[model samples]
Target: MIGSVANMLAHVKNCSKARKVLIYIPYSKFKFNLLLAFERYGFVKRVSLLRYSTNRSEILIELAYNGYYNMIQDIVQVSKPGQRIYWKKKQLRVKHQIGTYFLSTSNGIKTNLDSTCVGGEVICNLV
Candidate 1:
């Protein structure tokens, strides 16, 4: 089994740094939702289902860029397989003024600012 979220984020960050126009990653529900969250933040220009198969599927991600600068500065994976991080509702305040956080809450995959009343595992943060 693979850590899909971490893998997806790493791929995105690497592609962005390389100035790649598109990236293909193994598809999964959580990764798709996380990509949607990135789209909401305008880090990804587009996210679409590229290939479908019973064995292995893929997601096509278009990296967002502004001229010579990449839209995504960095992606920090907070929760790893070995060290999972969780925060209570009261602890879910906006710790950073710049970046936004994506969390897996009971309400589904939502940003820290969105589902504050409920706490969840820290997925990743975009900076």
Candidate 2:
């Protein structure tokens, strides 16, 4: 299953025409696999783990693109749901951008939007 998914991503990477790439992985294990796959294909310029939270077992990846943003976006959109929890005790309806990275935890969605960044960040620090 992983191999097939990787192969599909490889296809997307091949057809990409953007200058930078942004790969978002809500789970760390899957993120590692993605990094490895990109590295193996020599398609990624740079990779970074942007956000981390103990409450949620997930990771957000930011990949620098050379000319494949649109392609990457297409692939990301079709990826499976990365939410770690099926339900939350304290449900919070937080606004999130199309490509913004986040992880859903057991506690629920926690964010501070009254500061620097809108939707600041969702920290699911419950489980």
Candidate 3:
């Protein structure tokens, strides 16, 4: 599970870079929440669940693109399995106009722009 989160981000980035319309990833609640956060911030066009072949589940992510470029420029994981990073609401800041910091707060996974975000683990920075 150490690389699960990183794998999820990689899948999205690689698929987008390859100009794919959709990508599938093994499903987990944490990954689903992260994808939802990405969709809320317009990084992904849509996200849905798929169940088939002996109840196995997968996530269907629709990559959002603008002409030749993808909506997600890059995803940098801040909190790793061995080293988790946490920040307060006041400490959270986004330095770039197109950048968004995703956090795992008490309420749920949320982007830095969420007015009600309380802050928890610094999941990743999305650009």
Q: Taking the tens digit of each residue's C-alpha lDDT, what string does model 3 give over 18-108?
A: 8899899999889998898788878999999998875699999999988888898888888998899988878765454457888888888
Clashing pairs in 3: none
TM-score winner among the candidates?
3
Off by over 4 Å in 1: 94-98, 115-117
Angstrom error of the Cα, residue 38, model 3: value is 0.9
> What's the TM-score of each model vs. the native?
0.87, 0.31, 0.90
Q: List model 2 lDDT by residue over 6-54, tens digit each.
A: 4545544544544334544445544455454444434444445544566
Off by over 4 Å in 2: 1-20, 57-127
> What are the lDDT scores of the predictions, listed in order?
0.82, 0.38, 0.85
lDDT for predicted candidate 3 compared with the true structure: 0.85
- Which segments of model 3 are wrong by more than 4 Å? 94-98
State the weakest 10-residue window (summed lDDT) of model 2: 118-127
